[model samples]
Every structure is written in structure tokens, then in C-alpha cells.
Target: MKNKIPNKIHIIGSVGSGKTTLARELSSMLNVPFYELDNVVWKRHEGHEDIRRTEKEREEYLNTLISSNTWIVEGVHNEEWVSNSFLNAELIIFLDINYSVRTYRIIRRFLLQKLRLEKSNYNPTLKIFFKMFKWNRYFEEVGKPNFFKKFGDYDDKLLVVTNKKELENYFT
Candidate 1:
């Protein structure tokens, strides 16, 4: 499976499903650059509020990355704007872990971030933590079904991993 992985890989999954972790691992193993869609969407500025990039800017940034020879892009976003990334990807990994596991990870991540043990892209707050749970629920109820309906055509290149064990086995 590792040998079968292509140069251009895109990973999409529900929140706390380890998209970033897997992308970083694969990027290191495959020696490909990795991109986080959140970073592209939210522009982080020191001592100032983070701002979202304009639609055109986001599209251009994504296009530039996708045009590269080899790269790994990971995010929970599976929107129409990001369809080009899906189309251009040689391989797409979808993490479909169970809700219980995902929720646990979400809480664990929040605790770690709050304790300063783990770094987060955004500030960790009580409101944001609860919102994560809601997002997880929304993804499970709505996002997953939509993803299946939309990207089912890409089954040839799509790999659905249901748990951490499967994910580990795939890269072994």
C-alpha cells in the first residue's frame, strides 16, 4: 500500500480524525511538501487577528500548490472550491473513524492544546472546544454522506481508513 501511494496525495476527514498527523507522516516518508487547507484559508498574522483569504486568493493559492509536482494536502474541507484538488490528486485518503473515537480525540486535543502540550492552529478556548464537538457531529451526520455522494466516482484512487489500526497498516 505504501508503495502504491502516489506523489500527489490529498487527505480529507472529519475534525480530529488525524488528517494533519497523517499528512505530516506521509510528507516525511514520501519526501513531498505538505499543505494544510486551514492555513490557506486563515491567514495568521502576529499580534493581529487572523483573517480569511479572499475567494480568489484562496483559489490561487490552492492552484499553485496543486500545480506542483509532488505534494500532500490535508484538511476537513470538501467544498466545491477545493474540487480541483480532488481532481488533481493521484491518491485521496478519507479517514472514516467512528464517532466515539473522533469525539474522544477532539477532547483530548483540546486538553493537550490548553495544557500547552500540543500546538494548535488557532487559540484554544472553551467556546472553540465545544464548537469542535458540534463540528464533529455535523461532519458525521452531514459531511460524510455528502462526501460519499460527491467523490464516490473517485473510488479508484480513494482509500477509506476506518480506524487508527488501518491507517497504521496502510503506511507499513
Candidate 2:
């Protein structure tokens, strides 16, 4: 790793792509706070019932996070409202891990969550588990391409990671 790491970083990936995992590692290594985009979109509550934030609220909340000096923001969202994160970030990581790899993770995660071995923000219901698969496919077919189209201009800072080892290499 270099003496100086990016102060503001944004990470985007499909479900089970390890976005949150990377963010947490970086946050711990850099001693910075990290926020997940899922929490930004949904206000979590007890008993696994979450409320979706309004467009205006989501934007405002995101803005507040990006306004910080040093942070790692990770999520699967890439849209107009999230443009500011890209603009403000010193590093943007696109986790393009293999589709099959992510699928395996989804299954593993759901089983762990169901067994209470893993802590998840939402309930590990059958419906949500199926949706994870659907979301992963959607990301592969639509989200990944859309992200490249939308954020390609940030190539100077963008790090397209196809494998986790590449991330370690980046830091070392």
C-alpha cells in the first residue's frame, strides 16, 4: 500500500460481490467510517421491517454522507442521485467478479443467515433469497453495463476489480 490512500472512496457491486466486505476492510485499515447504500435507501427497523425512503430523503441522506472528509461508501446503486459520490470520490471500485462466483456467495450467505450464523440487515426469507438471485442476474445483464456507461468518465480513479486478489494487489 502507498503512504496515502484515497480519502473518499465509492464501491459498487452486485449482490454477493463483497462490496460491504471491502468497505469494512478499508474502513478498518484507514480508520474511516463507511456507509452502505442499502441503508441509505431503506430505513431499517426491528423485526426485519424496513421502510423505503422517499427520493428527496434518499438524495439528502446520500449528500450528507458524501459531504464528509473521509469515507467509504458501498452499494449496488448507480443512478442520477448517486452521481455526487462518483464526483467526490478519490477512488471508485467496480467489483466485476464472476457471475458464478457471486451466485455461490448468494447461496452461502442465505444459508448462513438462515442458520443465524450470519448477521443480515433483513430477514432471511425464501422470497428474499430468490430475489437475491434475480438481482444478481439483473446486475449482470443491466447494472454492470449501466455502471460502465454512467461512470466510465471516472476511469482515472476507477478500479474495475474482477477478482479479490486484484484488490490486495492494489493496496500492496
Candidate 3:
């Protein structure tokens, strides 16, 4: 097995796949800083897709975080930023829960957010939920295999966790 005491970890998954939740958990378990990619990519805005900032700014932010010797970065934009962010990661956990469970969680998360009027930098809407699900499907059908192949070429440290129980055991 690769080093369990990873200085850096990247969690990549489709929407509602529990990437952020798992990231938070791992960060606490590992005593490392954690960052949510969506918060970095999108500023707070209403009725807007929120313009993406320049790549340089993003890189700068990531550099600052990764320089800390330990961090858990989670997001769906693996295709765009995984290599740069995860190249040095001692572990990469890809959450691959069932579609039904993910959909349920997405809906529940949306309702909770709306009811609580949560002050999220990026709000979750029904449209975004469906789009995310579609993206998740695409990833399952195409993204995961391709990512594994590509990531394998770079590093041998990877763990594909399908459920929370499995993840807990692996981490333990």
C-alpha cells in the first residue's frame, strides 16, 4: 500500500457523490487543511453561473494550500485540475456511490439548503442537480475508467471507494 500518512489528498467525484463530506472527514482524520473547489471557482452570485477566475489565480490558491505539507482538495473538475493538484498526493479517494443514493442525497441537500437559507457561496438548484446527475452518469460511463488509466500512468496511489463503510475501513 501507498503511504497512509499522505501529505496531500484529492477527492474527485460526480455531484452528490459525497466528495466534500468525505474530504471534510479525511481532513479531520488526517489533521490536514481542506478546500472546496467550487468555492474557489465560483464567487457568490445570484442568477449567474459565476465567472471562472484565471487559471493563475487558482494555481496560486492551490499552491498556498499544498505548500502546507498536507491538504484534502475535493471537486468534480478532475479533468481540469487533478494532475496539478493531485500529482503529489499520497492517496486519492474516488467516491462511487450508487446513482439512486446520490440522487437522494442531492435532493435532500437541496431541500435542506433551501429551508435553512444556507449562505453558500454557490447555491444548489434543481437545474444544477440534474446537470450534475447527468455529468455523474457521463463520468461513470466514461470519466472513471479514463481517469484511472490516466492517473495510473502518473501515480500508483489510488483507492476507489464505493461506500462509506468501505472507505471507513480503508482509512482505519
Q: Residue 171 deviation, candidate 1, in Å? A: 3.6
How well does each candidate superpose onto the true structure, as a TM-score?
0.94, 0.97, 0.83
Clashes of each: 0, 0, 0
Sort every candidate by lDDT, greatest first: 2, 1, 3
| Model 2 spans with C-alpha error above 4 angstroms | 1-3
Q: Tell me the lDDT of model 2 at 39.
A: 96
By TM-score, the better pick of 1 and 3 is 1
For model 2, the local distance difference test gives 0.93
Candidate 1 C-alpha error for residue 68, in Å: 0.2
Q: How accurate locally, in lDDT, is each candidate?
A: 0.89, 0.93, 0.76
lDDT of 1 by residue, 62-114 (tens): 99999999999999888887899999999899999888988999989999999
Better of 1 and 2 by lDDT: 2
Tens digits of per-residue lDDT, candidate 3, 19-94, equal 9888877778778889988766655467776877677777677767777777888887765554677777778888
lDDT of 2 by residue, 45-116 (tens): 987579999989999999999998999999999989999999999999999999999999999999999899
Alpha-carbon RMSD, each predicted model: 1.5, 1.3, 2.9
Model 1 worst lDDT run, 10 consecutive residues? 1-10
